[model samples]
Target chain A: MSAPFYIGYNAKMPPATAAFLRRWVVALFVAGAGVAVALAGLQHRYGDGQFEFGIVKSFDGIISESPYPNLIVRRPIGTDAKDVRSRVLLVAPGKHGAQELVRGLEGRAVTLQGSLITRDNQSMIEVRPGTIAVQAAAVAGDDGVPLGNFTLRGEIVDSKCYFGVMKPGNLKPHKACAIRCISGGCPPVLVVRDADGMAVYFVLAGSDGGAVSSDVLDKIAEPLEITGEVERQDNVLVLKAEPGTYRRLE
Target chain B: MTLAYQAISWNRQKRVYDTVMAGGVLTFLAVFVVTGLVLHSEITAEALLIRALGTGAFLLLNVVLSIGPLCRVDPRFLPMLYNRRHMGVATFLLGAAHGGFALVQFHALGDVNPLVSVLTGNTDVQRLSEFPFEWFGLFALVLLFLMAATSHDFWLANLTAPVWKALHMGVYLAYAALVLHVVLGVLQAETSPWLVGVLGLGMAWILGLHVFTGWREWCGDREHAGATADGFVEVCAVADIPENRARVVTLGGERVAVFRYDGKVSALSSVCRHQNGPLGEGCVVDGFVTCPWHGYQYLPETGASPPPFTESVPTFAVKIVMGQVWVHPRPNAPGTRVEPAKIG
Candidate 1:
């Protein structure tokens, strides 16, 4: 600092005088980057990724159909509470195949032991080839009694990311990602409003609950109306639509 | 420069310059983290850091790519170009951080190797909509790493300027990969329109500036190239060049920037020593001929960098014949103090 800062505008630096940047300036940068990497590594909080591995779990519920020819376990909300779709245990048919296992157990209480995997709070039990036991004989079950058949409008969203993983994953912006997740074997879900306009989530299944994910992959994240049999299976409410029954809405 | 080139020649100005830049980077991270916590209290530390670094790297890359054409348009932006390599290296580190975090978050603890998982996890590349977009980001990050690793002047000298320039140009391909990475990966998962908008605008701005600057320079070069008289090429009149501006002319296959300033006309090579910036586009500031790219200055008459700086460019002799200015087609050795021709 001087009384007069006599500046020379003509003082030019030689180009070869290329001063390599100061070492510590780079060191500081390297140190900063190292810290960020360390923190991320420590936060090693990993996810099961798009698909969760099949883990065995014991589930008890009455086998009933939403609209699919197959069945989902309508587990009671609690020991005494009435059953609802939110507490449904969507049953994927055992390796024995769907027809034989669900031949006459539509209304009966059944106990199945299999590997259970879940996403978006919805659970599924892939029955271990021979672990399904019928606790009660077949009776008049509420498996798609054609409570009503009408056109319903809503969106087909991948259950995994839509429910809680990512906020607003059901929108158009997530349309493509939703398609990928569903294609990867996550169960496709249809979100629609009931009489009172409450959002109800139905786990989409084939006529045999085989894999409706492939069938509806194109419909994920799209608003659509489908004509199907709306049935109440104990607590699991389902819409059973045949292939090609879903129509895309603008 | 030798094979074992010194990392950097530290100087007073460069130290301060880098210190300020480093401070800005840290400050950006702090603000990003604080805001993310306030808005998304449950957002993981890893998620916040990964996102912040990813965005920071992208923004810096845009700045790096935009600097060339920006300097072409106006020399005032040259200061940013001075330590642009540092910015590039920093961008690569940020990108690496984002990639590392993502790898740890999704691929670690699996049966397969983490890197292998990154490759195989999203093997749906055969399908258009389900292509492995994350792999594109990985590829781009690898390119960025190669760029940062070879950013030193030692590499430049060893590879030769032309080869170095071509190799660094891989950044454009890397940029394309990143665009696809974001569109297919985050755009699908995030459900946000703002990121896509910002990406679109940044791309448009960078590409538009390059096209505009290139077109203008090409047109200017072809116009009034060689109208010779005697041994000198007739350039525009002293009045044709604006005050403190230049009239560029190509003669004998050399581009000369004939500047008219302070009622005197001086000519120098159009190429800047720093990054071959167009000196003709840069105006004299405070009596020094400043490069429009990195603000490297020269004494107009001698084409010499001021004492202690040592950089220089070739000077040309200018004469005013009739009303038009003429430049001697021969170039004088760099730093030769030729007298400026007075404009009448």
Candidate 2:
């Protein structure tokens, strides 16, 4: 008896199991396809640009006009440069005296025949058909002649001043200040001296204490040919110069 | 006497069937372990599923092949062979899952037409050098699907045994294709030394078991020689027996169990038929012989019932002269022929 043999041997299984397997396979395929479709839709949406926006507001007052007599009107600072909107006023000789001209214009602008000078000792005078439209500073005066042809020097001291007072006492003492001095009634200026001990003047303009307009400030270090005469009243030094006295440095 | 009779009546068929089923289940579990550990990857999720399916299919086929040989060696393993088509269907279903996932992942989402993509998507197939290797997996998958589709008893009855057997022989082609599939697709593509070693060891184990068992059968021919007439039937001397032993003999191509115990000799059908395990290979313990395969037993003299086991083998007459043991091929009433072998 080697080993028992089974003839006609065969194997069988329940039908339900096969049906269940087929169902499971079909469900997996459906779920996988769904995910692929969802991902493709997301990719398409992000590729196109179609989103949203939001806006905001601000304010300020208009200030000075240009000084040149024959200039055409131009645009306000914030507007695009090509647009022109504002105007300038003109003044004739004898129509207004310096004090009356400076007075009637409280918030209004006026034309005056005078030079522009810094309180720290530098000066310049206007020549020929000279006129400028500006709102007068609080301490502005007729006798406060824009100084020129005067020599003065001192250690560059700090002061709060803007363009109004050129007299010594007008500047406050010992206050730390930027070159743009507001309280002293004169814009701050740099003080330099020549070898002959003559005061060489350089006017600070704007907030940065560089010299004034190039035509007037460029001859700063050398002797300047000026037509202004100095006037002293109550120990305050001021220079009164004829418009023609303004000349380039020698 | 009653106790001896009670001990010899166990059923053998059910026992053999149970063993084969258990073996098939174990093989299925073993394949699951291999696939789960080896086929993990993110991009190739579909590929992994297919590989797992292939592994499961191969395991089922291996189990099916083992069942027949195992049943012949131990009829206690036959019950497992009875319900094995379930395993085959399971393998087919798993293979389908693999194919389905591969179709959707690589083909449905691909740029080409879905059918074309499935047919040509595998780079291994497109490359000329890898053609046959890649085609082997496709062929195996198709073969498994066909077998699984026709795995019902309905098909078995309709097809006839020879035709059914012939059709099922496609499993061999499937096996060969799977071997090449693994070699080319997994081994060549993965290039992992660990995987290579594992695959090599598994193939070696299966081949080794098959070869060793086959060799053992070829070398062991222990059948008895000379037939002697006793009444109308011829008896043969199976082998020399000691005081309490037995030998298996064949008469007219029918197997019979010959036993010598308590100073007498007796014979019975080698198979219990209820499960078909060798009755002679059983031991003469407590005056009854217990089958070495599944423990079915029979009394050496009466060949009667054991409690809880009602099966019996056909009893034959036996005798011994000199040192020779002999068996009568014709069966007789259980207790009539009991010529015990001489103790030498």
Provide the TM-score for each candidate, comma-separated: 0.60, 0.37
Model 2's CAPRI class is incorrect
Error of 1 at B192 (Å): 7.7
Clashes of 2: 32
Output the lDDT of residue B249, model 2: 62
Q: Candidate 1's residue-wise lDDT over A1-250, tens digit each?
A: 1011111122333232223223434554665454334332232222222222355556666665433323444443223544543334443321112333455567677777665444433444445556668887766644344467657788887655554343334554345445555654545778886889667766565555345755785566656888776665444456678647788775
The prediction achieving the highest lDDT against the true structure is 1
Quote the true-contact fraction of every model.
0.02, 0.02
Question: Which residue window of length 10 is worst by lDDT in model 2 chain A?
Answer: A44-53
Best prediction by TM-score: 1
| C-alpha positional error of residue A48 in candidate 2 after TM-score superposition, expressed in Å | 28
Q: How does candidate 2 fare on TM-score?
A: 0.37
